[model samples]
Target: MDLTDTVAVVTGASSGIGEATAKALAREGCSVVLVARREDRLERIADEIESDRTLVIPTDVTDEDEVTAMVEETREVFGCLDILVNNAGVLRVDPVAEADMADFREQVEVNLLGAMNTTHAALPVMLESEHADIVTVSSVNARHPAKEGSAYTATKYGVNGFCRSLRKEMADEQVRVTIVMPGPVDSEMRDWENWEGRALEPTDVAESIAFAVSRPEHVEIPEITVSTTDKLR
Candidate 1:
């Protein structure tokens, strides 16, 4: 999976791990398509990366039609899609009894269905490529249930299950499906000042994804779990 000149679409590229991943891929000479709701932030990142092969599509991953357009635009501009990074996601922490149903629903919509929409749209293009990769950014919550995270965890777990099955289904194909379940990371998703324990940086997770994608075409990395050395489940 040589990243040089390969087009990699990264959702939620406006910030956090998505931003870091986009820049990392650009540095590796991968053509990057940044998809997110914020066009201004995407513009800023594009300028910072200064990659001639960068495309910014302001899209809400929860919308199937927008995702389709994103993929189409990527194809139109890049002529090929090699990697799809389903990094678009959201999180909310609240107990079921006290949680707002709207927040829970938004979590499912963005984290679960967003991945479905983006992956569904990108799969056809990836399947056509000789060597392609689909990397899903999930969370440790998918494996361990944390207090006040039932709804958020449900979406993460749902993606984990879907990707696990898809990985097996595509085992014989050229397309590789890999899941990345990360622990607490220093990103916009959490407050760094209020945190008491260790947290992995966004680039830490980004580098791991890059490593997985850089592996040989004959190898398929099913899953990679990353967290700070001092941070335990």
Candidate 2:
């Protein structure tokens, strides 16, 4: 799983952990494909990397066509895909009893269906590589749910289940699948006023992804849970 010369497709690359992971992968000598709806932000990240090896694909993962195009475009530019990072997600916090159904549907679209769409499209390309890795960014809430976070929890749990099933299917192919669960992160998704001093930084989760991708081919770290030392919920 040496990242050098590898091609990684990262979703939600415009911000948060995906952004950091893209930069980290670039630093490790891996060619990166940045996918998100924000072309301008993707361009900014591409410019920061300053590498001709990067590809920016403005994609909304919820769309099947866009997800397929993302993988096709990555293969077109990089010639192969070695890694797929399913980091695109959305969070809506409200009790099911009082929550708007539309909000829940939106979360499911981006968080669960989005991961499925991208992973399904990326699998064939990954199978063509010598070694491949699928890293999914889940949440601690998937395992330990909170009262008001039902929809978000359901989507993360869906991601966890999807990754596990995908890993079993790829077991014979030697394609590694890893799930990372972070408690909370101070990112664009969070409100700074309420976050205060709590929560892990997006870079912390990004580093964990880097570590997983840098491991030996024989080593498959399936799941890693990370949280701020003080924020034990």
List candidate 1 stretches off by more than 4 Å: 191-195
Q: Residue 202 of model 1: what lDDT? A: 93
* Residue runs of model 2 more than 4 Å from their true location after superposition: 191-197
C-alpha lDDT of all candidate models, in order: 0.90, 0.89
Candidate 2's residue-wise lDDT over 1-233, tens digit each? 55789999999999999999999999999999999999999999999999999999999999999899889988988899998999998877776899999999999999999999998999988999999999999998888876688888899999999999988998899689999998778887763233344788888999999999889988999999988877544
Tens-digit lDDT track of model 1 for 1-233: 56887999999999999999999999888999999999999999999999789999999999999999999999999898999999988878876999999999999999999999998899988888889999999988788767778888899999999998988889788998999998888887863333467888999999999999999988888999998777654
Best by TM-score: 1
TM-score of each: 0.96, 0.96
**TM-score: model 1 vs. ground truth:** 0.96
- Model 1 clash tally, residue pairs: 0
RMSD of each: 1.6, 1.6
